[model samples]
Target: MEYEKLVRGDVELWKRKLMKRSSLLNRTAKKAQTKMNGLIPEKANSVITESIKKMVQGALFGSEYLTKTKAVRAATLEELDKEVKEKLNFYKKAAAVEGAGTGGAGILLGLADFPLLLSIKMKYLFEVAALYGYDTKQYEERLFILYVFQLAFSSDQTRMETMDKIDHWETYKEDAEEIDWRVFQQEYRDYLDLVKLLQLVPGIGAIVGAYANYNLMDQLGETALNAYRLRWFNERENGQKQEKQSGL
Candidate 1:
């Protein structure tokens, strides 16, 4: 129970951090990213957006064959957290290696890293869902994975909006059809644009690629862990309320 209390405290702190307004530096950077996004040709933007849309849809529909991890049941939160952390480390290493290999090769290979890295991230989320005792086979659960992805990579404003949806997922799920793929693609591409661009440079590409990929995975791991914790505590509180109502 002590561990549960500590975990709950961590989740509360994380939620507060998530909802906080962006700092001046972040706001400035976001403005610059917006300007850069606006400068891109419409045709280029359309192609990129369509590609990401198809890639993500493919991931969601084809994930059943990709994810081998079974849903974990009958485990304490502590046990689940331990396994999740271990799996996070494993994925980080894999991403780093992929980044390095692609980055070190040449510009063509570096360009190829985008879809490969996306696949790795999606697979990692699928496994994390199973570890948290959620079945990705369910359509809603796959949508939840997309929300987690958006939460981790979106701008500060979008992050808060996504967090609100995640916080009230049970109610939100009732009417949720699908996410806006254009918004999803734009936000994700903007978030990684600078670092991934640096990963194309000849000399420093290898180092930048490895460091960027590792840190990206680390960020996703932290976000995914806290997102699941929110759901875990929500379910527990709801169960308590139901039990009290029944006793009455």
Candidate 2:
């Protein structure tokens, strides 16, 4: 009963967060992202678009496949989250270090931060999924991780849309649109633009990079935890319904 109460409280907090509206800063950041993208040469933009699409796909299908699945076990939500928090912290620190290293360097080295940060995020998600007792090696679960990514980094409109799909995922998963990687990359870039753009500057780049990467990882961790929590609660509800119907 206590365990259920704790999970319920967490879900409530997550609800408030998801329903919260975007701020002026968020709107401005998104606009800035769009403008920055516009500044890129069309040919270069196309090249990047393709590159991001392939990079994301590779992350989705790659490491998780080679990883051993966690043995299925029964544990309370708190126990699960305890482990989850540890992993989140571990990844957060790692991302911060990576960000600081790249950001402190000149422009040429700072450019490398993108793929490195992406790998950290994807690898962390896979670990989180495994901790939550999900099998990332499965195609659908890996796809679910992408939705979680969308939920974390997308603009408000896109985030809500992605949230709905994740909320009803068991049913909605089958029909979820083939993620438009073009849009995916756009929103993601826009979301990161404000902080990441600053990371290109000379003196302050390191500070911005470390702070930004730390927060980004934190955001992703929250999204992943709540998403899996939603799944856990829904499964519990389904189990209860079945039990009552069976007069257990």
* Model 1 segments more than 4 A misplaced: 39-44
Candidate 2 structure quality by residue, lDDT tens digits, 74-124: 477878888888989998999999999999997987888998899889988
Instruction: Give the per-residue lDDT digits (tens) of candidate 1, residues 1-248.
Output: 99999999999999898888878987888899889889999999899888899998787766667888898743699998988899999999999999998988889999989888888889989989998889998889999999999999988889998999898988899999889887899889888988999999999899999999999999999999999989888878888999999999
**On a 0 to 1 TM-score scale, where does candidate 2 land against the true structure?**
0.90
**Candidate 2 wrong stretches, greater than 4 Å:** 35-46, 65-74, 246-248
User: Backbone clashes per model, in order?
Assistant: 0, 0
- Which candidate leads the pack in TM-score? 1
lDDT of 2 at 112: 89
Worst-scoring 10-residue span by lDDT in model 1: 57-66
